[model samples]
Every structure is written in structure tokens, then in C-alpha cells.
Target: MILSRLSIINFKNIAQADLSFSPNINCFLGNNGMGKTNLLDAIYYLSFCKSYSHIADSQIIRHDEDFFMLQGYYDNNGNEEEVYCGMKKRQKKQFKRNKKEYGRLSDHIGFIPLVMVSPSDSDLILGGSDERRRFLDLVISQFDKNYLDTLIRYNKALAQRNALLKQEIKDAALYEIWEEQMSVTGEEIFKQRKSFLSTFIPVFQEFYTYISGGNESVGLSYRSHHEHGELFAQLAEVRERDRILGYTTRGSHKDELEMTLGEYPMKRIGSQGQNKTFLIALKLAQFDFLNRNGFTSPILLLDDIFDKLDSQRMERIISLVSEERFGQIFITDTNREYLDEIIRKTGHDFHLYQVIQGNIESLKEEK
Candidate 1:
């Protein structure tokens, strides 16, 4: 799948904008704080039914604006369809496909696949476990609707179980009910994550080899809080402590994806460049996985990533895009000269857009 057009109104810094995209590689080149990343965030919102940057939908609306709207046209398996989303403060966010309302956010999920490479993604390696967990959950949630439903139900059950634990109810039998539900849901989550990693690890390794020149062995290991062999029994053993803490403390949420370089933690041992490359490699692998499956080819969003790399690594990334490895990428920079330099060396199909304040203008078209 590919986006053919995008329309934004009173969103972020953009007051009102509409632009057509090149089906091959549409590039957005502009300086920082010019709403470059915000533009890509709008596209992401349409695909995932939420903003990529903000936790709340109201944050996307322009200052003093009552509401905001984003619409995208996509070519899905040779059939054209339109996805529209509208957000307002103190009101519900609405989503529609082909002018018909969607009943659930899940209905619109994964209709369009996307892989984003932001400067903040380096956190996936160096940051806390929650960050890595989010990385895994977002990717898996998109491809598997069942996983999404299970995840939602698991979280709800976990919350209710925790709330009950905090209360003064003397019903010791209630703890058994929570444990059984937690075991079932947590086990499903663990199994799906393991299955996904089985597919993901090889792809990640191959990418790391390519990007790192095969110098070091890159590894990803899933480490759970409880032994998979003893998961149920362990949950039973820890029930007392969990109730004292007022939470389900030993489940999938406590599991982690460990990133290692050679024999050391990538976060501690890898250099800045290595960390950035690893992050990019992981995202590329995600793109490849989605592409290999029947899912849509993701539009690569590189948000000020050039600023975080050296010329060598920058060229490496440019080569990947130049080789047409990623479909329809949007890149941002603080200076036009940076993009101009790469554009000078690489002869590829793309368009340049000049962004200032909330306005955007395309410079040239593919000939």
C-alpha cells in the first residue's frame, strides 16, 4: 500500500494544507521547527488512528482551534480508499473510511503499515525496558488483530485484579481468579512474543551484519520476569507479594527484550554511531518483515536522523534509500544544504518541499 495524497487542517503548526505524493519516493526536506516532523506525524495518525508524537489527540490541534482533521488516500491492492480522522478537545476522536464511520479503533489499525526512524528511537537500545516493550508491542499489534484484542483484555484484567488487591476484601478466593486469568493472558502474550521474535531475530541479525560490516555479533534475547518453564507456579508463589504491592507484578509487562553487542550490553558498550546504526537496522528489519508479509510496504519516516550521524553513516542510509529499499520516505533536516549534498550525489526519484512556519511548498517534481 502507498499513500497518494494527504490533507491536514488546523493540525499542529499547519493551519490548512493539501499535497499529492509520488507513489515511489516522496521526500519532505525542510529545516527544524518548520513543521516537517509534524507533517509526517499527521500521516502516521491516519495509519495508526493516533498521533505518533503526542499522547493526547488535542495536542495535535492548532492553538485555539476547536478541532483538527487529517485525511489520506491509499492504493490498497489496486483499489483506492480514503481514510479520514478528526480530533477535538472535550470530545471523542472520529475515524471514517470511504465516508463511513468505523466502530472501533481496531477496525482501522494496520490498514497502512509504517516504519519510523526518529532520533528518539536510539532510546530503544539505551532506554528503559518499557521503551523496548513499546517497540515490540506496536509492531506486533499492527499485524495481529488477535494480539491487539488479547492485549487489551489482558491489560483490563490486570488493572481490575490490581484494584481488587488494593481493597480490603478478605476474599482470599478472589486471588485465585486473578491468578488464573493472568496466567492465561500472560501466557498467550509470551507465546506470541516468542513466535514474533523467532521471525524478528534473524532479520535483525542480517540487518546488523549489513550495517555493521559483520564486525560484531548482534543478539536479541527475550528475558521474562519468571521462567517460562515455571511461569504458572511462579505466579502462584508470588501472589502474596503481588497483593501487597497492589499490582500484578510478575507477567508479560515485566518481560524484556535485551539488546547485546558481542558479549556486552549494546547500551553500555556500543558507541553513539553503533547505537544509531542498531536502531536503524532494527527499523529496517521491521520494514522488511512487513513487506515480506502481505502487509503494506511502509512509508519510511526519518525525522532529523541526519543530524545524529556522521557523513559515512549518512551516506550508508542514503544508499539504502537510493537503492529503492524503502518506499515513499519523508526526511527532515535543519539545513537544506545537508539534503542538497546527498541529493547531489544520489540520483533518485523524489520531490523537495520547502516548509516555513506552517506553510509548505514543493520545489520540483519527478521528471
Candidate 2:
């Protein structure tokens, strides 16, 4: 799938902007704080219905603006689609497709698949388990709509059960009802997550080998609070403990995806370079999986990918991209020299845009 055009108004530092995009490669080049990243973030928001850089939708609105609007036209899996997002500083954001409002965010989820590789990817190795869990959940949610529905229902049940636990319930019978509901939803979540990992792990194994030149053996495992075969039974056993703790404790909500390298945990054993490579490989693996599954390959967003890589590593990555194997790519960098080199070597058709202080302009090839 390809994003043919994007329009942004009052988003971050960008007061208003519209840019036509190429199907293959689109480069956003500028110095620091020039809003190059914001352009990519806008496209991402249109696709995902949220921002990658910030949690609050209000923060995406430019200063003094009451709201922000972003829209895009995409050729999604051979279907032409239009999507729009509008957010107010004090109200919830709204999403629409084909000019009709989407009643639930889940209705719009995964309509456009995306794979973002930002500088903060080191969090996969160094950050807490929640980060990795979130990565897995979001990616899997895109691939499995039923998984997304189950996840949403499970989270709602969990929240309500936690709130009930904190209440002064005189009757123990009420507690039983909530417990039964929570256990049912939680078990479904656990099962879906385990099934997802069963499919995802082999893909990772293959791509990790491809990206690492067959030298490093990479692996991923799912860690859950319940035993592999006893998810429901474990939740039942934890009822008393959960009641005392005022929250449900054992289920997919507390699961993790652990990354390892050659029998050693990557968090401790992998170098910074290795971590970055692994994250990139993980994204590439996702791309391949999506392509094979008949979903459009995600729009690949690379932010400052060249900053942490040597020329050789950068060349390898560029070679893979230039193989004309992926979908729309939006990449950002401070210097255009490296990109120029890749263009010369690969001869791929790409549009170069110069960004400065929230403004963008297409640059002509130097004669």
C-alpha cells in the first residue's frame, strides 16, 4: 500500500501543510527542530489514529490552536481509501473513513499497517517489559482483528474488576460475578497472545538470521503470569490474592516478550549496535510476515536510522530497502549526503523534500 498524499493542519510545529508522496521512497531532510519528524508523525497518526511521539492528542495541536486535523489518501491493498483524524485541545479525537465517522477506534484499527523504527527502539532492550509487551500487542492487533476485539474487551473487564475490588462490597456473591467475567476475558486474551507468538517466533528466527548475516542466533519467548496450559486454572487459584490486592493479577495483561541471543538475554548480552540491528530485523520480519499474509506491507518509518549505524550497516539496510521489496517509506535525517549515495548506488526513484521550521519544499535534482 502507498500513501499518495497527506494533509496536516495545526499539528505540532506545522501550522498547515500538504505534501504529495511517491510510492517508493520519500525523504524528509533538514537540520534539528525543523519539524521533519512531525510530517512522518502526521502520516502515522492518520494511519494508526494516534501519535507515536506523544500520548496526549492535545499535545499534537500547535500552540494557540484549538484543534488539529490530518488526512491522507492511501492505495491500501489495491483499494483506494481516505482517512481523517481531528482532535480538539479539550475533547477526544475523531476518526473518519470515506467521510463517515468511525464509531469505535477499533473500527479503524489496522486499516493501514505501519512499521516504525525510531531512535528510541533501544527501549526494546533496556526498557521495562511493558514496552516490549506494548510492541507485541500493537503489532499483533493489526494482524488479528479478533485479537484486537478480545484485547479491548479484556482491558475493559479488567478495569471494571479492579474498580469493583476497591469498593465496599458487603456481599461476596457480587465478587464472584466479576471474577467469572474477568477470568473468561483474561483466558481468551492469554490464548490469543500465545497463538500469536507461535506464528511470530518463526518469522523472527528467519529474518534475524538474514539481517545478522547468519552469525547470531536470536530468539523470543512469551512470559505469562499463568502456566502454559493452565491459564484459567491459574486465574481461579489467584482469586483470593487478587481480591486482597484489589486487582486481577494473573493473565495476558501481565505477559511479556523476552528477547534472547544465543541463550543469553539480549538486555544484558547485546551491545547497543546489536540491539538496534535486532529491532530493525524485527521490523523487517514483520514486514515479510504482513506481505505474506496478504496484508499490505506496512509503511516503513525510519527516523535518524543513519545516526547509530556505520556506513557498512547503513549500506546493507539501504540495499535491502532498494531491492524494491517494501511499501511506502518515510525516512528522516539531518544530512542528505548519505541518501544521495544510496540513490546513486541503487538508482531508485525517490522524492527529496527540504524541511525547515515546519515548512516543506520539494528539491530539484542538482544539475
* Number of the top TM-score candidate: 1
lDDT of every model, 2 decimals: 0.80, 0.79
lDDT (C-alpha) at residue 161 in model 1: 70
Q: Highest lDDT, which number?
A: 1
lDDT of 2 by residue, 1-367 (tens): 7998888899999998888888877888899899988888888788678888656887788999899999899887678888988988788888999889998988777878888888777887788887887887778777788878877877777777677667734355665565566567667777777886788788878766765677788889988765555555665666677768887777667888889989999998997767887888887777776666646777888887777665666777877776667757888899888777656765757888899999999985431
Q: After superposition on all CA atoms, how large is the RMSD of candidate 1? A: 2.0
How many clashes in each candidate?
Answer: 0, 0
Per-residue lDDT of candidate 1, residues 1-367 (tens digit): 7788899999899999999887765566666788988898888888888777646886888999999999899888789999999978889998999999999988777778888888778779877998998888888887888888888877877787788778845476776676677778888888888889999999988877776667768899998854555556776776678768877777888889999988889998998888888888898888888777645677777777766566777776777766555767777777777667656655666677888898989987764
User: Candidate 2's error at 72, in angstroms?
Assistant: 0.7
List per-candidate RMSD values in Å. 2.0, 2.3
| Clash-forming residue pairs, model 1 | none
